[model samples]
Target: MNIKYILLPLVACSAVALAADPPVEEYVYGMRLDIDKVVAISEPDELYAPCRVVSAQMTYEDSAGQLRTLEYLRLSSVCSDIEGSL
Candidate 1:
């Protein structure tokens, strides 16, 4: 009914929508990953870079039904092409 009351909910929703997501975790050598069901994976920016290391994010559910996210590094897909060419 009032302007203040209407604006309050809108502000709250905006805050939640604009909140920054946490950075993905970097993978370590021999680190154990417990990915249950794959939710989504963030795509690499440079898919065409040859032999270049690219960053990726994986969102998944763990064995305990907890949602988790992990970031890891991997060679670009083009690397395989180069390797195969040689």
Candidate 2:
């Protein structure tokens, strides 16, 4: 049997796999409010330059116990790049 013929299918399969999206990982995080104050978040340096804070809003609970809502600020960073040693 020729080695090239045997390897051809394996190479093709790997190529297709490589072209697919990366596997997603899910994680949860906890946060605390240290103090009530104006807040600012900085983008990680690896992200593309000129990152923008897209939107911001405030929500609150009314004295009557009514619910409130807030719009989240959207931030983008160049997360497609894998950084650091695996």
Candidate 3:
């Protein structure tokens, strides 16, 4: 008949579920990526600051069907119509 006791387990379970994803790894040049299927990817906000460097994440499955997460830096903008290019 205690509310806190019941809620504690629920909160703990939810946190574990949310953290079940694999940790992100920094991408390095010459690193072999055996991506077989892409599950999700972060999209940079190019409109905010076009040429700024931003962090990005990608979740995918490798050749052996193991889920993997990778984090890397990328340009905020990919468009060629910026001031310099214009």
Listed in order, each prediction's TM-score against the native is 0.63, 0.26, 0.67
For model 2, residues 1-86, the per-residue Cα lDDT tens digits are: 99999999999999988755233222224422222332333334544455454443333444554433334545544322323222
Candidate 3 residue lDDT tens string, 25-83 = 99998899999999998957566555667788999999998889999877655543475
The digit string of per-residue lDDT tens for model 1 on 1-86 reads 78999999999998887664544677888999998899888756665555777787788888997767788887776787788989
- What is the TM-score (0 to 1) of candidate 3? 0.67
**Model 2 stretches with alpha carbons more than 4 Å out:** 22-86
Off by over 4 Å in 1: 1-3, 14-23, 81-86
Give lDDT: candidate 3, residue 12: 100
Candidate order by decreasing TM-score: 3, 1, 2
Candidate 3's C-alpha lDDT? 0.82
True-structure RMSD, every candidate: 3.4, 16.8, 3.3
Clashing pairs in 1: none
Q: Which sections of candidate 3 miss by over 4 Å?
A: 2-12, 15-19, 44-46, 78-86
Which scores higher on lDDT, 2 or 3?
3
Model 1 lDDT at residue 34? 91
| Residue-level error in angstroms, candidate 1, position 17 | 3.9
